[model samples]
Target: MGQAAPSKDEVARRLADIGPGEEREIGEGVFMTMHRLQAIQPLGDGWHRAQSTEGSFSVELPLPFNDFRVRAQATDNVEMRTHTVGGKTPGLLAWSASCLARRDGKLGPEARAPGSDKIEVKGTPPVAHSRSVDLDDMTCILIVEAQGSDPVPPEADRLRFLHSLKRTGRPAW
Candidate 1:
């Protein structure tokens, strides 16, 4: 009845349009691939938004997968909210730390905190970030953390993103 399931290599692979630094560079050393992951500004007092400039990623992962991203550009700069393509969902949770930890390749200040800061999160996925990007803030550090060997749900990944930019949201799961 259903079509033959796509192979891990198939579903995991990024679209052809996904370039080395534009979108999903599905392979090793991914930070160099997912560069536009964070190129936006604050929307409200606490909401950051990024359009699907290169389009959103929909890799078929195992568990409650990470759906999309929320920039969390500003808390006071905006309305202190998470603005994904679906605005804000009821089950959308948030992270308490930055996904830019050394574990993900960048130098994040986790020594001040206790948690691994790797941010192994879980919960329903978010919508999409946005369609317009702000290249001035060419911060693509989250790419590695998002597409790394470890398994951090997209829901949790988004949370960490929001928190780092001082955005706010309650934990869903």
Candidate 2:
């Protein structure tokens, strides 16, 4: 004979007991860290790295996600640059852009980008490309454009930049 399954109310109660921004062990070795808007589930095998700061935000990336250079940083903006390999364009690059709206040292909703329209400047030798996405509390902008007549970067480079972004926290109300 096996133990009876928990009732719906019991399950609800158990879930309700978990406070916001709390970390709870959900499996034999896995832990689920809760946030106001997201839940971070790190690997039990120790392959994930935490990029969290006290009372700030948290983000974990896979082990292979590395080798990036800090291109710019400010009180509200952070940009990281990395290049792609095995592509036709050897110098193709990507960026992880995070522009936060901070009020009283807490995150808040910022101006959202209108849409993802691939805008290209006319009459320019090198192609000028720009795209922006609204990340709830921030706006992530990625620009892969002309660099002194350099050939347009491969599409794979832009995809890599979009896939590399990981948000650790939620936007403020």
Candidate 3:
């Protein structure tokens, strides 16, 4: 017989323990690879696969950071934001949409709210990367912020998470 697959809880613990500069699988065919930045430590607390309660879509997130910082009138459009935790810069503000066509411009007010100040990361200030992604039936908007001189999380990390957004085999109609 083959070895049994790891449970979800076990996967979460392993992802946390692996820290930065390492890759951990958060779900079936879903893997999160942490990138290292100067002066920043690795992240912990693992990742959880977050799905809309209505089963419209699914994505991955680091623990304790799943709260939506901003949301539209329609609950399907939302943005999950967080501060730096466990030594790792929390560079993720992932948005999910049930209908990309109907909700493209209705997500994250913070993303729409404009102006950004330069923040230091690895001793040098870099502008935060705010980007949008389209995943077939879902839409993802990613935002990474740098408060004052604090370092912004890497864009690669945000992209990784954004790309992981997938529809959960449910019709959005």
Candidate 4:
């Protein structure tokens, strides 16, 4: 027999209690780790920095903020890391992106141009902005979705979030 899944409240509780550098196993072969920024500078009022150590990138988000390094191991040595923030906060947008590194550490394909799309949700139409940055050995694909309200987030907010994304360096793992 298998164990019952956690309730929504329980899941929320766990996520709320997670602190910097703490890691939790949310699924089989998938791990989530909260990150701590080495240095935090004030971008503005009511915003915080979210960094992914494994992905080696950082972005800024509004208050009531947190970021997680989600690792899904496919095999003994193959894994992918996705960095995310603000998925559960009402009235606030969410950001989910991933960085992929070539094992050979060579320059890959040219980075794609930044673009935007409209996604239909239950209550409103969310806007999705996507961009890619090519590093020495990796490509970071960033996609941020603004939704959960009629007007969605302001265009300035979306641009700020997207423009704040920075590649710290190559992935550590």
Candidate 5:
């Protein structure tokens, strides 16, 4: 006869002890992989460089952050790639990319120089900054949003996050 299956509690205990960068089979044909988050390295004065999981872009954020990537269907033929980085402290940043082909091969009228603006909302932070860049057939937008009770992030911090976005010429999608 086959061996009895492990108890739920026993499986939980085994999973609890698994270390990062490790993988284990808890049951027949069932595997779990543990991944360690990339370290957020400091660049002095409360700023750190946050890189996308795909290494396509990097931006300077005021605090340690965790980032994730997502892909969504934008249209029948185009998909959107979104990379978001946020910290527990007080800000959220994201980069989004989509094919420029959807826009009839031209930049939209809103595609102006990168800048910051004040957006007043009753119970939310009032600052939103964004910039758009065109790379080959892709259009990428970088946005930094203020969070928490503060009316806005420090001017320097907001600008740093907005102006520090760098793309490595890699395809975002």
Candidate 6:
């Protein structure tokens, strides 16, 4: 049988083991290949969560090479973001090209924001590259997005979810 892909828990462990400004290779030739990951940490009010990560990766194969940073929050649910900065050239064409190259799985149509950007998913398998966001500052493009995903223990509704789970010693499911 083929080698099994690394699990997110394994990824989290590797990430947590890394120092704030360190990097690790979770997967080769993949987005996780050239990464230097920090731990998945808590933002605020969320106690169960340990940390979040911020780092970049590069692909130097196929046709268009790209360099981008990845940020993600992993709990019972996983949420992530990618910002591409270098590659072919500047302008929408480059952004689109990189974004297209970095398509993971499509965001559920129902959840897609009104003006979510279009991406191409042909180059790598599911999530080959990272998404690109156009910004003017250039210095602060890796801003974190809001988190609203339904976690396993259901951190979304933290008050009841956290309280009940702690007492019951069971997931809110």
Best candidate (score: TM-score)? 4
Q: Cα lDDT for residue 63, model 1? A: 19
TM-score for each candidate, following the candidate numbering: 0.20, 0.34, 0.35, 0.60, 0.53, 0.25
In terms of lDDT, which candidate is stronger, 1 or 5?
A: 5
lDDT per residue (tens digit) for residues 1-173 in model 6: 53575798976666554543344655432333222222222334432231111222221111133333443332323333443322222222221112211122323223333233222233322222223332211111111111133111222332231121111111110
| Candidate lDDT (C-alpha), each | 0.29, 0.37, 0.40, 0.59, 0.51, 0.28
lDDT of 4 by residue, 72-102 (tens): 6433354556665433246545555566653
lDDT of 5: 0.51
Ranking by TM-score: 4, 5, 3, 2, 6, 1
Better candidate by TM-score, 4 or 6: 4
**lDDT at 3, model 4:** 61
In terms of TM-score, how similar is model 6 to the real structure? 0.25
Model with the higher TM-score, candidate 1 or 6: 6
* Candidates in order: C-alpha RMSD to true structure: 18.4, 18.8, 15.3, 5.8, 10.5, 18.9
Q: Write the per-residue lDDT of candidate 2 for residues 59-110, one digit (tens) a residue.
A: 2332222211112223355322211111112343322233343332322224
Regions more than 4 Å wrong, model 1: 1-5, 14-35, 52-173
Candidate 5 local lDDT, 112-154, one digit each (tens): 3333323222233445556666654345555555444444556
Residue 35, candidate 6: alpha-carbon lDDT? 28
Error of 1 at 30 (Å): 22
Best by lDDT: 4
Clashes of each: 21, 0, 0, 0, 0, 8
Report the lDDT tens digits of candidate 3 across residue range 20-129. Answer: 44656554433444433222112343555555433255555443332211122334444321111112234433222222322433324333432322222332455444
What is the TM-score (0 to 1) of candidate 3?
Answer: 0.35
* Model 6 root-mean-square deviation: 18.9
Write the number of the candidate with greater lDDT, choosing between 3 and 6: 3
Tell me how candidate 1 scores on lDDT. 0.29
